[model samples]
Target: MFWASVGFVGCILISLGSNIVRKTVERILTAQVIIMWFILLICVFTLTSMNDWIKFFKSLVENFGKIPPDISWWTLASAVCFIGAGGISNIWYTFWIRDAGFGMGSLIGKIPGWRGKKTSIKLSGYLPKPTKENMRRVKSWISNLHKAFWLVFFLMNFLAISLFAVLSNVVLHRRNLVPSGFEIAVVQAEIFQSVAGRFGYFIFLFMIAMLLWGTQLSICEGIVRQLADTTYLVSRKVRKFVKRDIRKWYFYLFILFAVWGMVWIVLQEFFSELIKPDFFLFLSANIGLISQLISLVMLLYFQYFIARKYLPKRLWDIYKPHPIRTVILLLTACFWGYFVGMAWMEKLGLLS
Candidate 1:
């Protein structure tokens, strides 16, 4: 799912960001998602032995020490910042717009009376009448409880990331801080203890690497699309050109990212000698989470401000009961939150 999303997102926003790092990252995600999935699926269905997988992966590495790995906690923390700041705020904006509706005033009333004939004539069967069912669903879905869900989600992610970071640190180190790149290589080197184990480990990492790429792509492409959409909204005249060329740019961007990811992987395969078995997975997790958090925050913000303008009337689909709403949101929020938070707190001595 993550790979697919990344590929889709990359394809959407390849041309917008000019920064080398930004563009490279986006392209890397695109490539990784596509390639990694293909390889993983083949391995899974083929019933290949884990040992052989690990050994085969080791043979691919070259020079493998440039990037620093962080825990998922950091990313989760960042994501929390986005959702709290933007997501809920926009949700409020949506409800507010609905509540405002057409105004009521004596002078205005007179105008309505005066213009009633003209207004009637203008609106005459031109628009569909609003219905009650959707409104009910919307009312049911967006509630205080849902707000709590996002809140919990953020908090849980924080906890999960933090917890894992702490644990990884303790289990691997004496000073209680994450190890350096050399140290990580040393630890990861354990996979090489046997060819099969090494191969299996790479297979696993390859899968995750692809997922990370997807998450990254999901976020960046989102930015590109929103940017383009915002441009169109700001001025309809730009729509024809933006619409015509944007999709192609989007797909190419993903392809570019996927290639970068593969390049990195290829390099790693080239230099498997200097690396040790010990690596900080937490760091990688954190990097991925950074994008997730940004998306979450932006999602909330857009839903309220820019998106509301384009949303039309079908958005109010909040029909779940308060309990169900709370439970569902709570579960969704906490699951990811705790999962992410555990990684961070573990690093910082904030969790068990």
Candidate 2:
């Protein structure tokens, strides 16, 4: 709790002073990802015996149906909802890119706060005219963004999850041990310590701290930026009051969020007792699933109707989402929609 508080306060301070928080987050997170990858490789090579790997695969094949049981539908649903929530949050990439002054975001300007006048926001909706050169540049920028997303987000998540599963199977499952509550982290660390001893335990602790710190910092900044951008985009009165200085609004929202978070932290146990933990999880998952479904629909609408209508004909080939991609998006929405419906029914006591 002490370290968590320190990390949280440090993130808030860094966010207050830094206008280029996205770049800072990228650098730090990239380092964390590298470290995690190194640890994962080390564990796979040194910790996991060949017999463990074979037994892990064999267990999956033979006892997969017995795992987690059919009664854990809520847990499975929550996991799905979390993934959907994560997918929806990816929309924030556009906001971050714009803030980072990449491509057309460069023209929109950025909120300068303590970073100085050079980073000040300028109010404009100007987009570059579609010339072959500009189109090529835009395409290149988008391609690079996709590559970065896949390498950093997809690859890292895949490897981390894979490592966890492998480690859990090899270390805990063999002993019929299941980690619960506070024991979760302790058990997970055993994966590393089993191979590298005390040094591995220290490395695991460092990795957790770095991951949480980076996540908190990025989330704090991103939420502030998104809230400020949305407010400015939606309300003329608010926009006039803030003028081109989005940093003012960002700071205001930051304080508001901080205060609210502190209140929640203080009252968390009270709230937890008032609303059973399972019910709270259900409520959160329901909201997240609904939001995710809505965002997915909106994304498709923008891609198909808005972009096709407003975007230049010449740039259509470069900007248009492929048919396969659109179908996949729709399918994902449908999948989440079904689960959300089931979750709601379960909440209403109509489904079990």
TM-score of each: 0.35, 0.86
Return the top candidate by TM-score: 2
lDDT of 2 at 126: 61
For model 1 the TM-score comes to: 0.35
- Extract clashing residue pairs from model 2: none
Off by over 4 Å in 2: 50-68, 83-87, 118-124, 190-195, 269-272, 275-282
Kindly report the root-mean-square deviation of model 1 from the true structure over all alpha carbons. 15.8
Residue lDDT tens for model 2, 260-344: 6556555655676764545655566667778878999998888888878987787777888888888988898988888777767
Each model's backbone clash number: 89, 0
Candidate lDDT (C-alpha), each: 0.43, 0.71
